[model samples]
Each structure stands twice: as C-alpha cells, then as structure tokens.
Target: MLKGKTALVTGSTSGIGLDMAEALAREGANIMLNGLGDATEIEATRAGLEKRTGVKVSFMGANLMKADACADLVAATQKEFGTLDILINNAGMQFVSPIEEFPVEKWDAIMALNLSAPFHTIRAALPAMKDAGWGRIINTGSAHSLVASPFKSAYVAAKHGLAGLTKTVALEAAEHGITCNTICPGYVSTELVDAQIADTAKARGMTEKEVIQKVILEAQPTREFVTVEQISGLAVFLCSDAAASMTGVILPIDGGWTAH
Candidate 1:
C-alpha cells in the first residue's frame, strides 16, 4: 500500500522499533532505520529486511539525545530516499527513580531522547513533508503519558510532553496534509522488559513468574503484554488513507492500563 514511499524509523535496530520498520517495509515503503546495536548485527537486520521485503533498506546510527544528531538523521533519510514520507519517532530511554533521588543527568537524557528528539526530527522533516503535501508522524509514547507511575518521574514527564508535542504538530501541519499522533502502549514484552523482570525478581526476592504476574503485569487489566505486531499494525493503519482524519489522537494500545 505504501509502495514508492519512504519511512524513517528511529530506534529500529531491534524491539518495537524494528517491528514497525519491518511492517512499513512489507507494505512496500523504503526504510531508513536508526538505532544503537552491534554494527554487524544492524547490517544483518537491514540486509535481511531489504531482501525479504524487496524494498530499499538502510541504517544510520545517531545519538538522538543531541539536537544536531536528530536533525542530521532526518536529513540523511531525505538524502537517501529523496523524500521521507513517514517519520516515526520511536527512540526513547527510561530512568526509574524517585523524583528527589533521580539523577539530574538521567532526567536530562530521558527528556532529550523521549521529547526533544521528536521535536528536532519533526522540525527538520516537516518542511519537506509540507512541500510534498503529505506526511505521517508517529511518536511512540507509553501509558505513563496519560497517567503516572512511581519511580519513573523523568519518563512520565517526557512522555506527557510528547503527547502535547504531537497535538501541537498535528494542528500546525493539518493544513499541509500531515498527520501527527502518539501511540501509547502498556508494558510490552521485549528483551528490555524481560531483563527488568529478572532484576526485579532478584531484588524483591520473588520468583520470575511472580514478578511477571504481580509486579510487572499488575496494573495491566488484561494481564498481558502488548505485542509489537499489534502496535505496528495500528501504526500502519494510521498511515493509511482511511485514517486521514485521525490526527492529534493519543491512541492507547495499553491493555486498558490507562482506562483506570
């Protein structure tokens, strides 16, 4: 459905970002992936996706905490694909600690990556999208965006800021045929979450199963992690013509975590 278009997905070397990239590529969109990973591994992923989807795939690693790097990443995508039709700001970091005890540096890093990076990328990419008269901007937010979680002050604040940013961008770009929205997901099962579960289990003197059931999935009403494929599928739909009017929406795929 997206043949001849191009998408730039940040933090796409693995996990949810990689899944989104693959989904767009499978729909025939050329992909430019950005993230941190083993150089060899990233190349293998890039090559494999390109081969399987029969669409152009490329990778560019950027430290998104830096404003210049975020801008440069967008520029690189435009230069590579000649036009960037889709921009997915899926890069983010988390630091969990009491607000009083949170490291200043950690808070800054989270805000930079989770909030400011999208601003920089969208600023760089919007003109081209405006000129072309079409664009889709998707920001991967968390349930924390609409609610709160203890020991996650920085992450929560950044995500809330991202939600506001998405709405502002949507309003500004509405006349240019550009749509901006945030996808807020609940706890997702990924390598990072698995590692967290193990650490939490050890720290709290609980079994892994207990950690998964009580500590991790406690607040999620469905008691299940949101799947990467499900989030990717929603993203694909948001980019489709049928969703042309769905802008500035903070759609949650959080298994009812935010419904409370």
Candidate 2:
C-alpha cells in the first residue's frame, strides 16, 4: 500500500524501530533508517533489507540527541528520496530514577530524545508534507505517555509532553491531507526493556520473573509484553488510506494497561 512512498524511521537500527522499517519496506516503501549501531552491522542490515525487499534502503546514524541533527536527518532523507511521505519519530532513550535522585544529565537526555527530537523532525518535515499535501507522522509514545510510573519521572514527563505535541500537530495538520498520531505501547521485550528488568529487579528487591510479573506487567491485565510486529502492523494501518480520517489519536496497544 505504501508503494513509491519514502519513510524515515528514527532509532531504527534495532528493536521496534527496525521492525517498523521492515514492515514499511514490505509494503514497498523506500526506507531511510537512522540510529546508533556498529558500522558494519548497520551496513549489513541496510544491504540485506534492500536485497530482500527490492527497495532502496539507506542508513544514517544521526545523533537525535541534538536538535540540528534531527533537521539534518529530515533534510538528508528528502535529498535522497525527493519527498518525505512518512515520518516515524521512534528514537528514544530511558533513564529510571526518582525526580529528586534523577541526574540532571539523564533528564536532559531523555527529554531531548523522547520529546525534543520529534519536535525538531516534525517542524522540519511539516513544510514539505504541506507542499506534498499528504504525509503520515507517527510518534512512538509509551504507556507512560498516558500514565505515570514511579522512579521514572523523566520518561513519564517527556512522554506526556510528546502526547500533547502529537495532538497539537494533528489539529494543525488536519486540513492538509496529513495525519499525525501517537502510538502508545505497553512494555515490549526489547533490549532496552530487558536491561531495565535487571535494574528493576535490584531496585524492587525481586527476581527477574517477579519483576516481570509484579512490576513490569503489574498494570498490564494481559500479562504479556507487546510485540514489535504488532506495533509495526498498526503503524502500517495508520499510514493506509483506511486511516485517512484518523488524526490526533492516542491509539494504545498497551494490553489494557490504562484500563484502570
């Protein structure tokens, strides 16, 4: 459905971002992946996706922590693809700490990646989207975007800010044949979440499974981590013609995490 479309997915070297890229590519969209990873591995990934999907696939390890770099990322993709049909703001970093104990640097880092990076990319990409008269802006929010979690003040705050940003943009672009939405997901078993499990176990003084059950999955009624493919599939749907009327939507795939 995305044939001839060009999509730039930030933080796509691994995990959900990677899955998002692959899913879009499978739908015939040209992919421009951005994130951090070993040089050779990223290249191999880039090459392999191109071969498998028979679509042009490129990679740039833009440091999304910087606002200017985010603009440069959008510019580079525009230069390569001639148009930016879909923008996936999936780049993010997490730091777990109580508000008082949270390091100032960590707070800045989380806010920069989780919140500010999307702002930069969206601002830069909007004019083009407006000119094209069609665009899809998908922000990767989390359950934290809707609810709070203890000792995760920075993450929660940034995600909440992101939700507001997504809604605002959607309203502004509602008449432009452009749609903006945030996908709020529950915990997914990615490397980032895996590392957090250990930290949470130590912090909560519980075993890994206990942390998984009592901590991570505590509020999730399904007791199951969301799948990367599931998110990617939803992303595809949002970019489809069927979703033309859906904008400013905070669609959650949280396994009922916010039901309470």
Candidate 3:
C-alpha cells in the first residue's frame, strides 16, 4: 500500500513504536527506526524488519529529549531516504507523582521528550512533506490527552499539548496535502505498563492479575488493554489515500475511555 514511501517512527526499539514500525514496513514503506537501545538489538531489529517485509529499514539512535538530536535525526533520515512520506512521533515516557510532589527535573524531561521532540520533528519534516504534496504525520497521544489522572501530571500535560500540536499542524498543512492527526490510546500491554502493573502489585500487596483488573476498572469499559496492532491499523488507515480528508482529528483507540 505504501511502496516506495519512507516512514520514520521514533522510540521504535520496543513497545508500541516497534509494532508500528513493523506495521509500516509491512505496508511496503521503508523504515527509519529511532530510539536509544542496545546497538546489536537495534541492528537486529532493523535487519529483521527489512528481511521480513522486503522493505528498506534503517536506524537512528538519538536522545529525543534533546532538540539538537531531534534535528539531527530529521536531517539524517532525509539524507538517507531522500523523501519522507510518514512521520510517527511515538517516543514518550511517564513519570508518576502528585503534582505538588512532582520533581522539577522529571517534569522538564517529560516535557522535552513527550512534547517538544514532536514539535521539533514536525517543524523539520514539514518542508519535505509540503513539497511532496502528500504526507502523514501521526502523533501518539494518550487517553490522558482528553482526561487527566492523578499522579501523572507531566504525562497528562504533555499529551494534552501534543493533541493541540496535532490539530494546529493539521490546520497549517491542510492546503499542502499533508495530514496531521493524533492517535490517543488507553492503557496498553507495553513494557512500560508491565512495570506499572508490577509496581502497583507490590505497593498494594495485590496479585499481578488483580493489578491488571484494577487498571482496567479505571476506564469506563473495563476489559482488555488496547493492542499495538489496533493502534497501528489506524495509523495505516490515516496514511492511505482514502483518509485524505481526515485531519486535525483525535482518533481515540481507547475503548471508550474518553467517551465518559
């Protein structure tokens, strides 16, 4: 579906990002994987994706929290691929604490990586996307983008800001055949969530299964976690010609988490 296109997914070494990268590759888009991880692991992932999907796959290891590093990643991707058709800003992390007790450093780090990095990437990639006359920019937001939770002030704030960014970019790029949208997901079975579950289990003296159930209960529709493939499928749809008219939209694959 995306033959000859180039797609860059940040923080793609593992978790949701990795799944999305593979999804894009399966659609025949050349992949540029980004993140900080084991060199061998990164290379192996790149090689594996390329071999499996028969699409070019490359890696860019950049600390996305740094503006300069983000800029460099954009430059390197453009240099290698010559043109970029898709940009998925999927890099983010969480630091949980009460707003009154939130560490300044943690707040700053979350803002840098979760919010500022996407802005830098969009700015850098816009010119190329605009010139191409067609592009897709997918920002990975969270259900928190619409509704906040306690102890996740920085994360919620950054996601809310990202939602705004997505809308604004969509408006600006509307005339140039570029579509910008945010994919807001609820709790997913990522390594990050696994750690959270473990922590909750230990802190509350509950079993892992009970911790998972409690997490689910927080949402209106208490059930399964959102799957990476489910989110990736939406990304694929957004990149398709059929979705040309969709922009400035927050497509929540959050199992009705925000509907309430």
Candidate 4:
C-alpha cells in the first residue's frame, strides 16, 4: 500500500516506535529509524528490518532534545530518501515527581524531547510533504494527553501540547492533502514502563505484580497493558488511503481509561 513512500519514526530503536517502523515497512514503505541506542545494535536493527521486510531502511542517530539535531534528522532523511510521506513523532521521555519537588532540568528535558522535538520535525518535514501533496503525521501521545495523574507533570504537559499541535497542523495541512493526528496509548510493557514498575515496587515496598495492579492497572478497565502491536496497527490505519479524511483527531487506545 505504501510502496515507494518513505517514513521516519523517531525513537524507533525499540518499543512502540520500533513496532510502528516495522508495520510501515511491512506495508512497503522505506523506513528511517531514529533513536539513541548502541551503535552496533542500531545498525543490526536497520539491516534486519530491511532484510525481513524487503524495504530500504536507514538510521538517523539524533539526540532529539536538541532542536538542531531534530532539524538535522529531517535533512538526513530527505538526503537519503529524497521525499518523506510519513512522520511519526514517537520520541519522548517521562519524569515522575511531585510538582513541588520536580527538578527544573528534568522538566526542561521532558518538554524538549516530548513536545519541542515534534515541532522541529514537523516544521522541517512539512514543506516536503506539502510539495508532494500527500503526507501523514502521527504524534505518539500518551493517555495523559486526555487525563491527568499525579507525579507526571512534565509528561502530561508535553502530551497535551502535542495534541494541540497535531490539531493545528492538521488544520493547516488539510488543503495540502496532509493529515496529522495523535495516538494516545495507555501503559505498555516497554522498557520504560518496566523500569517504572521496578522503581514503584522498590519505593513502596511492594512486589512488581502488586505495583502493576494497584497503580498502573488501576486506571485501566482491562487491567492489562496495551501492546505495541495494537498501537502500531492504529498508526498503519491512520496512514492508509482509507483514513485520508481523518485529520485533527486524537485517537486513544487506552483501554477505556479516557472513556470514563
């Protein structure tokens, strides 16, 4: 479905971003994987995805916390593929702490990676997408984008801003045949979440299972973690011809957390 097209999925070395990249590749889109990972691992992943899917795969190692790096990533993608049809802003991080105790540096880091990085990438990729007269931009938002929780101030703020940005870009790009949307997911069993669960268990003197049940799964009706495949499938749908009319929308795969 996406033959001859190119996709850039940020923070795609692993987790949901990796799943999104693989899904797009399977649809015949050339893939550009971005993230901070070990050098050998990054190259191996690129080679493996290219070999398995029979789609060209490239890598852009950019520290997305810096705007210049974000711009360079777009430049590198355009250099490698000539044109970009899909942009998945999946690069983000979270810092949990009481608002009063949150470190200023951590707040800045979260905002830069989660919110500002997307802005830089969209700004750089929009002109090409507009020139091509077709594009899909998917921002990887969180369940926090719709609802609030304690101790995640920076993450919540960045995701809310990302949803707003997605809407604005969708409106502006509507006439140009480009659609922008946000995919808000519930807690997934990623390395990030694994670390958080471990920390929670240690902090509260609870087992990992107890922490997951009482804290992570409490807000979810399914009492289960959302899978990366589920989120990536939605991304694939959003990038399809069938979804051309869908823009400025925030689709939540949060297991009814947002519904209630």
Candidate 5:
C-alpha cells in the first residue's frame, strides 16, 4: 500500500520503534532506521528487515537529543529515500525519580529527546511532506501523557508537551493533506520496561515479579503489558486512507488505562 513512500522511525534499532518500522516496510515503504545500538547488531537488523520485506532500508545514527542532529536526521532520510512520507517520533528516554531528587541533567535529556526532538524533526520534514501534499506524523506518547504518576516528573511533562505539539501540528497541516497524532500507550513489554522492573525490584527490596505487578503495572488496569505488535498495527492503521480524517487525535492504545 505504501510503495514508493519513505518512512523514518527514530529509536528504531529495537523495541516498539523497530516493530513499527518493520510494519511500514511490510507495507512496501522504504525505511530509515535511527537510534543508538551496537554497529554490527544494527547493520544485521537493517539487512534482515530489507531482505525479509524486500524494501529499501537504511540506518542513521543521529543523536536526537540535539536539535541540529534531529534536523539532519530528516535531511539524511530525504537524501537517502527521496521523500519522508511518514515520520514516527519514537525516540525517547525516561527518568524515574521524585521531583525533589530528579537530577537537572536527566530532566534536560528527557525533554530534549522526548519533546524537542520531535519538534525539530517535524519542522524539517514538513516542508517536503507539504510540497508532496501528503504525510503521516505519529508521536509515540505514554499513558503518562494523559495521566500522571509520581516520580516521573520530567517524563510526564515532556509527554504532555508532545501531546500539545501533535495537536497544533495537526491543525496547521490539516489543509495540506498531512495527519499528525499521538499514540498514548500504557506500560509496554519493551526491554526498557523490563530493565525498569528489575531496577525497581532492587530499589524496593521486592522480587522482580512483585515489582511488575505492584509498581510497573499497577496503574495499568489491564495488568498486561501492551505488545509491540499491537502498537505497530496502530501505526499502520493511522497511516492508511481509512484514517485520513483522523488527524489531531490523541489516540490511547493503553488497554483501558485511560478509560478510567
């Protein structure tokens, strides 16, 4: 369905980002994978995706925390793939700590990656997408974007800012045939969450199992982690003709967490 189109999915070396990239690739979209990962492993992934999906795929190691680098990432994608028809702002970072003890540097890093990076990419990619008269911009937001929890001050603030950005861009781009939206997902079973579960277990003197149930998944009423495949499928649907009129929406794939 996406033949001749190009997509750039940040933080796509693994996890949710990778799943979305692969889904777009399966739909025949050329893929540009971005994020930090071991060189050999990332190359293997790039090659494997291309080989399996029979679509063009490339990798870029842009430091999304820097606005200039984020702009360059869009430019590099355009240079490699001709046009960025879909932009997935999936690059993100999270810092868990009380407001009183959250490090200043960590806050800055989270905001840069989670919030500002998307702004920079959208700014850079919009011109080409507008000229082409079509685009899809999907921001990977968190359940925290809709509701807050303690200890994740920076993360919550950044995601909320992203939600605002997605809405504003959607309004501006509506007449230009571009759709912008945020996907607010609940706790997902990504490697990042697994690590957080282990860390919380260690800090709270609880078993890993306990941390998952009582800490990581406590707010998720479903008590089940959202799967990467589910998130990727949502991205695919949002990019389709069926969703062209679905712009400016803050979609929740949070397993009923936001329903409450």
Candidate 6:
C-alpha cells in the first residue's frame, strides 16, 4: 500500500522501532533507520531489511538529543528518498528516580530526546508534507502519557508533553491532508524494559519474577506484554487510507493498563 513512499523511523536499530521500520518496508516503503548500535550490527540490520523487503533502506546514527541533529535527520531522509511521507518519532529514554534525587542532567537529556527532538523533526518535515498535501506523523508515546507512576518524573513529563505536541500537530496539519497521532503502548519485553525490570527488582527488594508479576504487569490487567508486531501493525494502519480521518488520536495498545 505504501509503494514509492519513504518512512523515517527514529531509534530503529532494534526493538519496537526496528520492527515498525521493517513492517513499513515490507509493505513497499523505503526506510531510513536512525539509532545507536555496533556499526557492524547496524549495517547488517540495514542490509538485511533491504534484502528481505526489496525496499531501499538507509541508516543514520543521528543523536536525537540535539534539536539541530533532529532536523538534519529529516533532511537526510528527504535527500536520500526525495521525499519523506511517514515520520515515526520513536526514539526515547527512561530514567527512574525520586523527583528530589533525580539528576538535573538526566532530566534535561530525557526531555531533549523524548520531547524536543520530535518537535524539531516535525517542524522540519511539515512544510514539505504540506506541499505534497498528504503526510502521516506518528509519535511513539507510552501509557505514561495518560497516567503516571512514581519515580518516573522526567519520563512521564516528557511523554505527557509528547501527547500534547501530537494533538497540536494534528490540529494544525489537519486541513493539509496531514495526520498526526500517538501510539501509547504499555510494557513490552525489550532489552530496555529488561534492564528496568532488574533495576526495579533491586530497588524494591523483590526478585525478578516478583517484579515482573507484581510491579510491571500489575497494572496491565491482561498479564501480558504488548508485542512489537502489534504496535507496528497499528502504525501501518495509520498510514493507510483507511485511517485518513484518524488524526489527533492517542490510540493505546496497552494490555488494558489504561483501562483501569
């Protein structure tokens, strides 16, 4: 359905971002992947996606924490593909600490990457999308965007801000045939979440199993993690003509976590 279209997926070297990039590629969209990883592994991922999907694939290790770098990533995509029809703002960071003890630097970094980077990229991508009269902007928000948990002040704040940014973009871009929406996902068993589980276990004086069952999955009434395929599937749908009217929606793929 996306033949000849180009998608830029940030933080796509692995995990949910990579899966969404691949899903878009398989549906006939050229892909630009951005993230940090071993050079060799990243190259392999890039080459493998191109081979498997028969779509042009490129990789850029743009540091998303910088506003200039975020704009440059969009520019690079336009240069490589001549256009960027879909923008997936998926790069983010998480830090857990009480508000009083949270490092100021960490808060700044989280806010930069999680909130400011998307603003820069969206601003840079909008003009061309407006010119083309069609575009899709999908932000990877979290359940935190709607609800908050303790010890996640910076992360929750950034995600909540992202939700607002997405809605504003949707409203501003609606008339141009451009759509902006956020995908709010709950827990996913990725490497980052794995580290979070271990850290919570140690901090809360619980075993890993206990943390998984009691701390992480406790709010997720389904007692399951959201899958990468499911998240990417919704992204594909949002890009389809069927979802053309679905702008400014915070569609949650959490396992009934927010339903509480």
lDDT assessment of candidate 6: 0.95
Model 3 residue pairs with clashes: none
| Candidate 6 local lDDT, 142-250, one digit each (tens) | 9999999988899999999999999999999999999999999999999878988886776678899999999899989999999999999999999999999999999
Q: Judge candidate 2 against the unseen true structure and give its global Cα lDDT, from 0 to 1.
A: 0.94
* Per-residue lDDT of model 2, residues 75-184, tens digit only: 99999999999999998988766677789999999999999999999999999999999999999999999999888888999999999999999999999999999999
Model 4 weakest lDDT span, ten residues long: 196-205
Alpha-carbon local distance difference test for all models: 0.92, 0.94, 0.90, 0.93, 0.92, 0.95
Q: What value does the lDDT take at residue 258 in candidate 1?
A: 85
The C-alpha local distance difference test score for the whole of candidate 4 amounts to 0.93
Query: Residue 242 deviation, candidate 1, in Å?
Result: 0.4
Candidate 4 lands at a TM-score of 0.97
- Badly placed stretches (over 4 Å) of model 3 are 199-209, 220-222
Model 1, 178-218: lDDT tens digits are: 99999999989987678767755665688999989997789
Clashing pairs in 6: none
lDDT of 5 by residue, 1-260 (tens): 89999999999999999999999999999999999889999999999999999999999999898889999999999998778999999999877776887899999999999999999999999999999999999999998889887778999999999999999999999999999999998989888887767756765688998988887777778888899999999999999999999998898988788888
Higher-ranked by lDDT: 2 or 5: 2
* Candidate 5 regions with alpha-carbon error over 4 angstroms: 202-205
Candidate 3, overall lDDT? Answer: 0.90
**Model 3 agreement with the true structure over 1-260: per-residue lDDT tens digits:** 99999999998999999999999899999999998788998899889988999999999888888898998998999999998889999999887666787799999999999999999999999998999898999999999899987678888999999999999999999999999999999999898878767755665577988877775456848577899999999999999999999999988888888889
Estimate the TM-score for candidate 2: 0.98
lDDT of 5: 0.92
* Candidate 4 error regions (>4 Å): 202-206
Model 3 TM-score on a 0 to 1 scale: 0.95
